[model samples]
Every structure is written in C-alpha cells, then in structure tokens.
Target: MDPFKNWQDWRKNLDAFFGENFLSSFENILLYNYFPQVNVYKTDNELIVLANIPGLNDINNVDVFIDYQSLELRGNVNLKYKGFKLIQDELFNGHFERKINLPYPVKEDRIDATYQNGLLIIHLHRLIPDDHRRHKIEIKKIEE
Candidate 1:
C-alpha cells in the first residue's frame, strides 16, 4: 500500500465520481423520496393511517382511496417562488404518491379522511362477514 493514498485524495476521487452537484442531488432525492412517511394503527373495528405531508397548500387537491387489501394516497405539493434564485431546496415538490397494504379487508364505502397541521389522517372500517360455510350432509354407503 502506498502512503500517498491520503484522505484528501479519496475525497477528491469520490467528489469526481459523484459529480460537482452530487450532494445537492442526493439531498433532493432523499427529500423527494417516492413514498411519504406514514403510520398505521388498527383497532377491533377500524384501521387508521396517518401520513406526513408538509408544503401542501390545499386539502382538496389530495386524493385518498381504500379497497379490500390496500390504501393509496396521491397529491401534489405546489410551491410558487418569485424571481429569487434557489440556492438549496430540500423540500419535496410535485406529485407524491404512497400505497399501503392492509392486514385485513376493509369496507371501501366506510372510508374517511381529514387533513390538519401537515398530516393527513385516514379512517377505514373493517369488513364484517355475514355467511357461514359449513353444512352437514348425510353420508351415503358405497356400493361395491
């Protein structure tokens, strides 16, 4: 091993490999990740999901959906800036979407949503079964 392989040389090589705007691009990717952070909770009769979504200007623009097996959230973060040059922006912008798998089937008609303080809360009611499947039949003797 050569003693000339110093920390500064390694850092320079890393910087060159990743390009001059590497850090900013990496930060942007992290900030605008595909999925928003969410928390899920379940009770005996319902399931609730809370998602963190800052920079949302209007609640009506967000869409929420739920089916028997999954839940989906989609929205856009509209940020309007004047003639000021953006030096470093780490906040997420544009359309954001997230889908979550539910542990049990849910009634789609009973779903509700509310947004407050940069968080969106969704409520889903569990589906109830109304049918019983086992029926007793008389056994017939097999003829040889």
Candidate 2:
C-alpha cells in the first residue's frame, strides 16, 4: 500500500531468505549471538535433549526445567571480556531462552543433566501407562 509497508514486506522476505541461507553460519557463531544449539530425540522409554550453551560459568545462573508438556530453558550470558574496545558485534550477548514441547509425558524426577564444554545435555525417561489404546477400523466399498 505505502512505501513503508512495501519496504517492511521486502525486508521480511529478505530476512527469511537470508536467514535460511546463513543458518549454518549463524549456528557456528555462538560466541557472538548466544545461539543455543538443541538436539531432541526419543525412544520408547526415554526422550533426550542436548543443548549447546557456551560461555556460561555459573551453574546456578542457568535455569533448566520441564513443566507439564513443555521444556523451558533459560539463562543469562556472562561476558568474558577485559578492557575490550567496541569493534564489531553480531552475537546476541544477553539473556536467552528456548522452549520445546514434549509429545509424551516425561519423568520429572528421573531427569539427568550435565553441562560440559558449553554443551548442556539433558536426559529424560518416559512414564508409560497401564492402559493400552484401543482403535476401531472401518471398511468402505468402491462404487462405479
């Protein structure tokens, strides 16, 4: 409609395209942006989540937990700089958060987590139900 609107749309399109193209590079630049890497997988009895959190020193500062069906991870980054002059900055040096929804219920009490080499690994086991799911099937005839 207007110039501003046209520019906004064009910017959004450009961002989407460039973001996809540079995703790999962006992921590699965690020191600048604090992009937390995440890997999720599941088995019949367990679900695991691995997150890459670099430049974090204090374990108490990082808050990691799962509530209900969603896993909430959040933490504030600590800057490790000494008499540094402003030059170029693209990395997000601030608070970060990432949420992931679980497909099935996880055992909250049986969670195992460890943070090493800027990588946070979390392990969770599934809680199975006593009752089994029941399903019904229907048949249809072909018509000419």
Candidate 3:
C-alpha cells in the first residue's frame, strides 16, 4: 500500500462525496449572500446610493423602504433561457433583501429613486434637526 496511491484514493472519495461542482456552488452561495452590490455616497446635504441589479423585468416590482437612518431593498433577478441548458451561471437570480444604515438621518419625503441600465440610483436629502430647542447651561464657580 503506497502512501501516494492511498492519498489519491482518499481525495477521489472526498471529491465524489462532495460532487465535482461543490466548490463553485459553495462560492456562489457566499457571493449571493450580499447580492446586488451597493455603494453609498454622502454629500453636504444629501446621500446617494447606487445598487447594481440586473435582469429586472419591471422596476415597479422592487420595493424600497426608507426609515430615519436606514434603507431597505427587496427585489428579484430572473434570467430564464427557454429551451437552453445553463452551462455556467455567475449572475445572481432569485429574491434578495438588504438593509443599509445611512450616515445621517434622511427625509422620507425628499427621496428620489431611478433605475437605468441595470443600476438603481437613490437620492435622499438629509434631515436637519431643530437647533432652536437646544439650551445652553452656565457654569458658576463656588468657594470652599
């Protein structure tokens, strides 16, 4: 019983157990965990978010929710080829939900979203807090 032959047999058994495409399937699972990559940008008075989501048949089907300082996105990517078998699939397909925290609170009514060329762009205005309600306290020195 040669060590090299035994090692090769063990590896073959492991590969058979896991399947030949096990590694690719595992990578796809990990990659799709954060599907539709997003980028957030902050300006002086607004925030801009860009999301890469393709294969959207209808933009109206996607749901976008904005809270005071958080944004939620829910959508699905469908790419079906009729009468054709999938040889390789790198694109994400199915339902996905992602929540993002904003750097500052945003005004719910002042948001605008648009989808163009597979990119979802959102513009949100920053919510300004009222400064008039803030009160300053005076310090007094005391003698012991």
Candidate 4:
C-alpha cells in the first residue's frame, strides 16, 4: 500500500485503466513565484548569491541581514509604473522578500553587498573553524 511510486510504472497502468490526457494535462500548469529568481554559488572561502531584481529595487532600499544560520533578504520592489496601464504586463510588481537558508555561517561583521544593472549581488566571507584559529604546535625531540 504505497500511495505513490515510480511515475513510469504508475502512468502506464493508470493511463490504460483511466485515460491518456489526464497526466499530460497536469504538466501544463503554469508555476508562479512571488520573489525574483536567485542563484547561489560557493567557493572555498566565501559564498556568493545573485538575485535578479530588475526594475524592482534600488541600492538604498535593499537590506541584507544574517542571523545564526540563515540569511534574510528583505526589500521593497518599487512599482514606479503603477499609474500607467500596460499593454503586455508580464513582470511582477509590488513588495517581495525572500529568505534563504545558508549552508554555512558567515562572518556577520564582514558582509558585503553590491547592486548594479538591476542585479543584487551579495557576498559573504566564510568563518574559519575554531580549531584552526590557533596553529601553535609543540615539538619534542626524542631522548636516546
């Protein structure tokens, strides 16, 4: 009594028993996201995330904050074109806030952010391990 299994096996049996367009129709539905698209990248010593926020935010209004293990991106997307009606309105407008869970805790004090060409680029430096903080080792010579 497993409710869900492999789609390939389930589809063949379900379609023959039911109908063909049932599954195909489900795939055609459009997906919507409130926040703009974002991409995250990692290096050995740092984490970089780029958010595509074109025509939505300015550098002064954008805010970047981190607490413990998560980074919160809260900002206002200005709807400058609010009064004008659009012939073809595809872009989303209004307020947008996206919070992302960071893989590693960064140096909260040394965070940097830059916005250029309608893209918000956030840079955070990784924190070094406590054990590696002190590299003092004791050397002993063997007494024969």
Candidate 5:
C-alpha cells in the first residue's frame, strides 16, 4: 500500500462527496464579502465612485448614503426567473451592502448619484474647510 495511492483515494472520495462545484462554492464564499464590485476615483476636488449592480427591477430598490468620510450602499439583485430549476448559477442575486471609504472628505450637500445600464455612478465634491472659523487666543502673563 503506497502513501501516494492512499492520498489519491482520499482526494477522489472528497471530490465525489462534494461534487464538482465545491471549489466554485468555496471561491464564492471567499469572494462574497465584496459584492457588487466598485471602482473609486479621486481628483483634486472631486471623488467619483462606480459600482456594478445588475438585475434590478426598480432602481429605487437601492439606497445610497454618504458622509464626510465614507459612502454606504444597500441594494438587492433579483432576477425574476421563478418556477424553473437553476443550473450553473453564477450571477449574484441577493441583498448586498458595501461601505467605501473616500480618499478625502466630501461635501455632503454636493453629491449626485445616477443609475444607468446596470451601473451606479456617484459624483461628490471635496469639502473645503472654512478658514475664517479659526480664532486667535490671547495669553496673559501672571505677575507675582
């Protein structure tokens, strides 16, 4: 009885028990954390975000939120093909939420988001702090 032969037999048994898609399933599980993949771009005065989220019946189903330092997204991808057996399921179909940190602080009031062609585009302007808000304090020396 060779050790190499025993190892091969064990591998065969595992494959037979888990089926061919076991590897794919494992990959999906590992990659599930970053669903609806997004690309972020930063300019001198603006920050742009592009997200890929398809299979949405209504664009309103997605919610977008932003703050000075981050952007939050919550949505669902539903492909309405019910009453049929699914084979080779690969497309993402479920609820997903992702919070992305912005490169710079963005102005909350000046933000825009649009959805078109299965893509969500977000445009934001960088926040410039007001210089006039700073005030000088006077120091007094104590006399003994």
Candidate 6:
C-alpha cells in the first residue's frame, strides 16, 4: 500500500509525525527554496490577492506583476543572523517566486498593491465584456 496518495497527504502525515514547527526544518533541509502563502478571491468585477510574507520590512524586498490573466510574484526575505547561536527556526528565507492564473480578464492598468503588517494585498479590476455567457464550440471532424 502507498503511504501517501498525494503531496498534501504526505505533508499532513509528516506534520502529524514531526509537528508543524519541525516540518519547516525538514522542508528546509529537503527543499532548495520556499514560497509564501497566498489567497485569491474573485468577484463579478474584481479580483483580490492576499500574500502572507513575513519579515518583509522593506518595500524593495518584494515585487508584484500582473497581466490580464496572470500574476507573478518575486521576492527575497533575509533571515541572516550574525554572531548568534541558532536554535529552532521555522520562518522561511531566501528568494522565492510564485505565479497565479486569474479566472477572468482584468484591466492591468487599474491594478493596485499594498503591503501592511506582513500581508501584501493586490486588487485587480476585471474587464467587463458585452457578453458574460460561455460560447459553445462546434467540434469538426479532423481528416487524419
């Protein structure tokens, strides 16, 4: 029998076995990079993205980019400790990048972003079309 069916199940089992804080250490040892957590919400006329990235004190440390249908996030978080004996550390550091696909077309020029209290919030205005219904496609027989 397979111990885990998917990545989420494996991560959950690992978290149960080693605890949440210790999983970070394990992930750091096994993985090359880390990514911040993000949540995306969509409405009829807008899309909102919230990224949880701790230790981002400088605005220059993070970058956000978006087009009509996609979003890209790139940044670096520094966790360098000088002259101190390190114990347990759960926070993720170093460079990270994440890309997200938006559900609807948006106006790229009307996008706005703000970072506060370790959370990066982005608002994108959706482009309204004359028709919002899905168009049916007619399948033609391909001559092979």
User: Which is the leading candidate under lDDT?
Assistant: 3
Candidate 3 deviant stretches above 4 angstroms:
1-28, 133-144
Q: State the lDDT at 26 in candidate 1.
A: 55
Q: Model 1: residues >4 Å from true position, as ranges?
A: 1-31, 133-144
lDDT of 1 at 95: 88
81-102: candidate 3 lDDT, tens digit per residue: 8999989878888898988888
TM-score of 2: 0.64
Q: After superposition, how far is residue 11 of candidate 6 from its true place, in Å?
A: 6.5
TM-score of each: 0.67, 0.64, 0.71, 0.64, 0.72, 0.67
**Per-residue CA lDDT of candidate 1, range 21-69, in tens?**
5555454454456446777899988998999888788987788877677
Best of the two (1, 5) by lDDT: 5
Error of 1 at 141 (Å): 25
C-alpha lDDT of all candidate models, in order:
0.77, 0.72, 0.83, 0.70, 0.81, 0.79
List the candidates ranked by lDDT, beginning with the highest: 3, 5, 6, 1, 2, 4
- Please identify which of the two predictions, 2 or 5, would achieve the higher TM-score against the true structure: 5
Candidate No. with top TM-score: 5
Query: Clashes in model 3: which pairs?
Result: none
| Residue pairs in candidate 5 whose N, alpha carbon or C atoms collide under 3 angstroms | none
Report the lDDT tens digits of candidate 6 across residue range 35-91. Answer: 666778888898899988888878798999876788889999987779986687667
State the number of backbone clashes in model 2.
Answer: 4
Select the stronger candidate by TM-score from 3 and 6.
3
Clashes of each: 0, 4, 0, 0, 0, 0
Worst 10 residues of 5 by lDDT: 1-10
